[model samples]
Target: MTLDLDPLRSGLHHRHDRVLIAAVAGGDTAHRTYGAPEAADAEIGSVSKGLTGLLYQDAVDRGEVTPETTLGEALDRPEGAYAQATLGSLATHASGLPPQPPYGGPRTMLRRTWRMWRHGENPYGDSVDQLLDEAADVRLGKPRFVYSNLGFALLGAALARTAGTSYERLLLARVAEPLGMTGVSVPSTPRCLGPTALTGRSKGGRPHEPWTGEAIGPAGGVRATAADLAALLGGLIERRAPGISALDPAADAPGASRIGAAWLTTRTGDASVTWHNGRTGGFASWVGVDRDAGVGLALVSATAASLDRDGFAGLARLRAEADRC
Candidate 1:
């Protein structure tokens, strides 16, 4: 089906070299790809966390865990500040954890920054064991809304450990397959990135290395095609997705008035947009749903730049169409 996504395209501002837009209204879904094949995969960054949120809720339903379940219990880690944080707290970014693993010294920071700027190298390449080691000696502050890659990394590990599987395997079995997102994957190594993987670019158009890491898979390592993400959103809109309740606001979040797991619900006009955006050193993506209008929209760009504004604009356009229908 042909979709007039001109409003969405205009919002792009010609900043993206490769773009994909998809929207679903009522029972009709459409997707369009520019500068890339429909099956090409791009990093979805923190959108992985939003998907993990669904997994967390699904685990709860299966009695595999609870929101109150401590990371220590699931991961079998020793009692400590990091391990003691609840799964729910991590899901909602209320774990009092820092954004990423804290690295001391200016030298480390400068080196990391230089590598990213010069080589477009991935800053995250740690394994699950490495991530756990870093969390071991950490201290946590009072729980509040603080986006934490570290917290999500551990959350995914904990969930996997409790399920006697790896994070990628668990995701495939529980989330992707169920939602008809076969193209979605959390590649742990560069070799795992299939031929359909699209190389990402910086705003200035410099090529970037794909961000791949076992530990980061739960937080920001997801890659998917336009169709896969649209399917995910459609499943959520139809209340057929596992952990559909995760879309409901459960706690306060920054920017958005409330958050459900990793999804942020923000008031825009007469609708509430439950959404999450992702940015990596290479790619950017946004996915949102206007539940009241039964519309879901998603955009993926193979460039390390912002797509949130365009995504919202696209979603608003789709919602308007739905209203008219």
Candidate 2:
């Protein structure tokens, strides 16, 4: 069941796709469509959360923070009602924040968007700041996995304030530079294409304006190369990426069979390896390693989907084969 991935690369790139791979185990690095001499780059969508997670980890390493930290304790008041969450909650999608712009219509998109800008482009697209303006009222009543972009946005804001600097600077100073992840940043253009729908194909306006407006910047605003991700993955195995094993979850964090901090720990069934996969608009990617075998893999693609049974199987086989190296 070992997969070579060369044909996969050819199939993707030949179909006008862009692909990149860094086999940490074999020291094999290839950029099929975009390289230093070529022309293409990976468009990481929610994958950016991993980068944000890494920043938070660096904050922890500096003893400036902890996963148990509450947003209220981190940020000063006057922002107002949404606190009670933590870095772990935001990174793990358990912060109970909304998925997209709270409300919108295609007809109203432009007008409301302008309004959002006028409102300071808050990621919540509402008076979420006002909600958390006071620490006394904000509640940690209950917690659930809401896949919160808003929480990450707030966490990034918190990180910036704690470091006494901007979020972008925090990223470079604490993350990108340390990991040698050059050229990873917010994309100049939108992350994905407009979906084909009307009703409007989805709710909370997700599959629309993901990066539009200003507030959700911290949630999914990042792009990086497979090579850089591979190096970062190496840090996981070497335990240098923030000096914590990306494979190990914190005591209070829920146990996950797949990943810790934007990484997948194990693939089940016929696949007996570990990896982390990502899907962005017009792009799909995965990176993982056979922890037991000391072999690693990184992959990138242009097609995005959720239930890619075949894609996952293909990646497992590819990684398993590479794991032999």
Pick the TM-score winner: 1
Candidate 1 to truth, TM: 0.95
Cα lDDT tens digits for candidate 1, 1-325? 2457656766686878588778888668877777888788889888999899999999998999999999989998865458789999999999988887754454354576588879898877778987787668777978998889888989999999999999999999999999999898898889999998998888778888888999999999988888888889889889888988888999988775799888899999888999999988878889999888888888889988898888888788887776677
**lDDT, each prediction:** 0.86, 0.52
Off by over 4 Å in 1: 103-110
Q: Estimate each model's TM-score.
A: 0.95, 0.69
**For candidate 2, lDDT tens digit of each residue in 48-164?**
666667777678778888878877677864344555677667666666665433343342335654644443231332232432331234333356655555566677778777898
